[model samples]
Target chain A: MKQSITLGSVTRFIGLAGFLETIKNVFTGKLDKEDFKNIFRKVIMPLASVLLFFAVWYLSANKLHEIEADHLINKALVEQGPAEAEKLRACIASGDKSCQPNALPSPVQVWGAYQTLLADHYVISADKKAFKKKTASLNAKRIANGEKPITYTGRPSFVDQIFTSIITVFAGFLLALFIAVPIGIVIGLSHTLRSSVNWLIQIFKPVSPVVWFLLVFMIVKTFTKNSSSDSAFIICFISVGLCSMWATLVNTAMGVSSVDKDYINVAKVLKLGPMQKVFKVILPSSLPLIFTGLRITLSVAWMVLIAIELLAQSPGLGLFVWEEFQNGANDSNSKIIAAMFVIGLIGFMLDRIMLTIQKMVSFNKND
Target chain B: MSYLELKNIYKTYGEGDNTTEVLYNINLTIEEGEFVAIVGFTGSGKTTLVNLINGLLEPTKGEVLFKGEPIVGTSHERGVIFQNYSLLPWLTVGQNVYMAVKEAFPKKSKSELNTIVSEYVAMVNLSHAINKRPKELSGGMRQRVAVARALAMKPEMIIMDEPLGALDALTRVNLQDEILNIWGKEKRTALLITNDVDEGIYMADRIIPLRPGPNATLGPEFKIDIERPRDKTEMNDNPNFKKTRNAIIEYLMEIGNERKSEVQKEYILPDLAPKSFVW
Candidate 1:
């Protein structure tokens, strides 16, 4: 298949060459009919091969999909009750089946469920006074129907939870950045500091996020009696943030300290002020390394965030995944899979954000 | 009084049992606006001497006096052109020169400083590549930028530590002429450290050779009485230029031979393996 693609590319190049020649001849008042035939011969056969390669892929993709589908079907049968499982198997094998074996609740069903969830919470209720009156009437209606009274979770709304998680992550990252970069610079610049801190950094750098969680949990328990609030979220965030900060701190310090001594001499000879020396000379020279550190730190922070959420039951994508995992249902696997996809997408976006920032500050454009 | 004076300067590296002498009893003086070249074999402590004069390194004994006052640490007053063309790689040629100009005249407006930097860049005939970084420049062009940077500072004395040593022969001659032209216009006190005898004779008012070391000191001084605005081809034809070059070369060769034997003697060892106990 790859070979056919290469052949196809060669044909495309031949076609381009022929087109260029025809244009050249038209401008120069000269044309060769034989050249056109030769170009066609060179281009057409390869183009046919490329088409043939894609045809093979088109044929094979369905076969691969069937194998995957069969695997999923077998797994689903093991989990289902005998009557429903037999029905699903019969539906799948019948070939005229209207229902897709792999389909979770249809898009329409999920959308309907989402609307019901939102309406139950009175999310679009007119105002606080109106919402209170509407809630009271709804409660009465539910009681008359002999339905259970809805209890408030005492946590934020879903949207508010998202906002809280974002704000916490941003604040935690900023706090980590504030502590790490300067410490890295000091470690990088001074031999004594580097040696003294090396053992400590090495020990802490590879420690798992769970250790940070337990340690932070203890500290928070001792320091603040207020759990089941934003303080819990902050505490969880700090745990992940500190765990993620070590790599960047060490990398930054090494970067700064390892800047060429010649540059230091230039700074000294220029008689730059201490602030100017650090900001202009030292920082600019170490930017590539510093950015690299930042990139590693951000990715690690994202991974640690998930671990923190899972362990602490903090509200975020991590908690969403944990909640889905705990609530087993016919659609739970799909939800877990969907949540994993979102986590990966968010991590990718974070990396891209760091890359954009790196591009903005980098003095070397060629890099 | 000489513009710059080194009175019985002594430098030793390490201490106690491990102590090793690098430079010993070095005494020299340069008159105002005079270009003095110190020629030596490699490892004869020529760089150490330049470093001391520039106050990059302090001498173990004796004082380096600029005018009548004792020399302190590195300052803007003493500009150094290092052999490596120590222009920052990240900055363009114009920016590198502007950095020094900016430091020397912190109160100047941006446009004013830019104009000054451009003038120096033009002086080196590198105006076309003013915005090019050091990595983009040829070896010769980079060194020219280094020279312009030092000269633009308007220091009282310029200390060049083999500034053109890394360039090709043709480039070296071209940069040498450029350096001489700048020195002629400014008439700043200049000290050049080089190993090339002809270069020393061509560019300096006086050439002094540093004797080969464990403990190297200044050898005899040869004064180049040749006239200024020296054309390399024309200078080669002059009898006095030939005489001065030959004299400096002979002194360097004599010191080289002494160093050769010293190394040979130091390395020759006696075979002693406890006499292989024959019991």
Candidate 2:
């Protein structure tokens, strides 16, 4: 009974209690009134809210489309007279791509844009595969001659850009973790070091991602000038790292410094070596807080990634959004809206991933 | 020389004008294999005294000696069971004990270390919870893990700082007997710091009161003349137990009252008002 209770609490701590219960209920076919209420609140309510959101978005997009179309017709009437205005109206009524209003995309338009991007990805994948097959012999010959192999340099599809963004964000998050945690431990260990370094953290913490990007650009451009490696990718990840690391650094320092005095005493009484004390006692005690910091760092990194990628001209979702907006085609708005949803969804997923990891590592359930 | 000795120890916090002397002239000595308990009220710097002996904190004046050598730093020879349990939350009961045992016996084989961890954990009646983390355990269970961890190291001396103070009466008594049973077997030099007079009388050969602080000092020592293998229920019927208990409690109350009276000394506040700034 004790073993079961402990196991139950452990599962509950990781936030799998409700989820596991639902799964059990589903398999057992024993859904009661309480379970039904839970399912309604947890699943149905969120879906309803999302439907309401889509409805509002669709209505607003339709309103804007109508307004823009009206404005265009009025301008044509005044500038090109009734014949041209009538011609424009006829063209719009026929639903020609050229005369379509460029406004906020409706839900249907966004869905169409999503399908188009997916089709574009497939086409690009086929083109690349064919290109590789065609160049196989030539590439082998080039490699035999000790020359660089020919490669396909094509515009990345929406899916490719998304993968790029995700990769860059992960690289940035790792960089933040590596740089922040050790420095935080050192700073946390010594009051003098903490106080002296505090000014630097304070000054740098709130600095904008744009500024960090510019700073990284200067350094990376210099270093990678003669190299074949992607400098913009380096700049994007570095900037994202620098922008997001402050929270983790500060939190880690706080966590390390405020470790329970009792734990420290335990460390002392055990006569643990300095390294053992830190690794066994200090790190374990401070882990929950460090994880909290890491969670924040990841979200911040993800949030800043798009901006950095945009600034660095990295072929990512940020660049995709910016390019779509600049293109100003009839479907550009729809495509941008589609990208927006993808970005939001990915960010939410990233946060959940961090949360799950934090829960796994943290002993304090309340945290 | 005694197995553990604290000579003229003075522990103060802060510096210059802001300094507060927490413990003053804390002199104590426990012979080899002797069990001693220091009884003090809350905020009477009992932990400060414990820390001083455990080598976690250095005295402002004087020094602590263990086995006729001046102690410079912590050693596995002296195991401390803290009031808060202090079991690393991330480690399970078995692992917490394993960590301490490993530190104490770095050259021991892995299998040997595991045996020690399991043995000590079982001694605390926590074998069922060997795989459970501290956060998953009840307060009493967590304290038991702490005890197991401390004992697993096989320290020559055990220093307990109110190890059972946070437990309910039933758990407290259970743990007290468990600790005494272990102590009886090994006859290790032990120092227990607590506020409960009955606990002091029940566990130790000598009960010494720590006078209330701002400058806390060791008060008179009351010797427990009761024979070994002391029974808890029969202790109430014993004449010596009653006498010692009353003497310790009376001494504690007297000091407590003195401290309270000293605290109640009124200070005249200067007549002042916030100056209204003219616009």
Candidate 3:
């Protein structure tokens, strides 16, 4: 059975074949049919606009190069003579050795940076394998001598940095769920507890990620004072998780409280135990809103994790961006820009994943 | 002692200027295995009265008693079937029934519980859609699931809050027969709250009218002396059925007209001028 493209809908996003086929059809003049108009509007039109943006960006980047070259030319003319100025002018005209060293890199430069990072990752992975083998033999010899075997500690690669960021955000989100959901339920069930927790929620809801990161680091540092890898990881994820937990907590409480009164009455009529009432009726009815809150919480966790990782110098994508900026090399700016797009794409994917899970559990879907 | 009783029940809401009385000095009783129906207008506080009896709401002036003990809270001994929005929409019809059965009979074996759930689902003639969720079924079907869920618990008494009120007329008559058939077999004490006079007369052993509120009270009880397995078509031919229905409807109409007069009357001064018509 064939799965037809449901144009102008989610299929345009999820069906890669449909997206590619539409573009191909347009080029081949086969997309003039009325059947493909929705595909054109929903899919091809967005692509056109994106291409237009790239064109504008490419042109502006070229203009920025000329502007900088002119500045340098004037400076050289004043300091030296026309001879050196002319040489710089020629390089500028040739589109080489121009633009401010720290100017924003164009898409092409960012693409190049992405390839370079990929190559760098491969090289580091090979190095890690070799290091592991060398350490294994050394550890074997040390074990034979009955001494403590040395462990190899190495820097994470670019790919490893991305994984680190993902894991940290997820860990924080899980922690937030663990802490917030039960509390939300309690607050939802009891008027007194709700009033008591309301103030705390209001006060802490808007506390900045940096502040949370600092507070978490201080607390975790005290606990894992002599620790290394595990401590930093725990600190990073916990800080982000706690900082982002307010959304899910508030939404969960609201969801629980606002579950249809009829359902609650049914629960009461059934004489369901407190636990049974919550799990059987309240939770199922509130699942849609709770999942909505969870989705928001997850996104918040992901957004805050980068900043937390950056502040704590935890080995994640945010740290990668910071380190690249500090490196101040020829391709450093481009590498940072590349990381920005990668961060954005990952955040989008995380939301989509959460949305899928939300749809699975929810009976009354909003979308 | 009566199986269920409400003594001098006066339910009020709010305080001071906001205080509004709903039910006033309502005393009622239901004997074991007796089927009773309370008929009322839309705002007659019938639901509030049902809630009081079910122990969901407390009466300001009095209390309810079940089996000689004052009702403190909701209990599995009294199962309730609401008109709508009763079953968990996420759960299948079978699962909805299973949930209640499991709660009421915690010691039942897994297989035995499954059997009880299916039996009730089949009893409601919804065996074909047992696996379907509440949202997938029509209004009548969902109500059937509610009925099945309530009956599966095997509660000593069943409280039905207009269980057939939302269904179509035909569906209502069909369900009325089904309920009667079920009640004939088990003889559980049932309290049905409905506005439909025919429905109340057809389903219950006694029909009671709740006068319209701000302080609604049970007006009069009409004992239905018709035999079991009463046919809806044959009910038109029965002289007792016609006489009883007319009496109930006539009582309801009197109360309805009384409530209408109770509303603030608009005044219009008669204009005493005859204008000359232009020829």
Highest-DockQ candidate: 2
Kindly list the per-residue Cα lDDT of model 2 for residues A110-150, writing each as its tens digit. 99999999999999999999999999999999999999999
Which lDDT value does model 3 have at A287? 85
lDDT of each: 0.79, 0.89, 0.87
The model with the greater lDDT, 1 or 3, is 3
- Chain B TM-score of predicted candidate 2 relative to the true chain B: 0.94
Interface RMSD of each: 2.1, 1.5, 2.0
| Strongest candidate by lDDT | 2
For each candidate in turn, the TM-score is 0.74, 0.90, 0.91
Clashes per prediction? 2, 0, 0
DockQ values of all predictions: 0.43, 0.67, 0.60
Please tell me what DockQ candidate 3 reaches. Answer: 0.60
The segments of candidate 1 whose C-alpha lies over 4 angstroms from its true place after superposition are A1-170, A191-199, A220-229, A352-366, B16-20, B109-111, B266-279
Candidate 2 lDDT by residue in tens digits, B19-96? 999998988889998999999889989988888888888899998888889988888888989999988888788888
In terms of docking quality, model 3 is medium
Question: What is the alpha-carbon lDDT for the whole of candidate 1?
Answer: 0.79
List, residue by residue over A1-367, the lDDT tens digit for candidate 1. Answer: 1345464444343335564555455678664797567546655565778788656755554455366557656776778656666776666667533534333333333445445434533653334446556578788888999996554444343344445556656666776788899889878878998999799999988899899989898888776774454566867788878888887798789789887877877887778888888877888888877887888788888878877877888887677667766876545445555556556767777777787677656666754
lDDT of 3 by residue, A147-202 (tens): 98986577778999999899899999999999888888889878888988799999
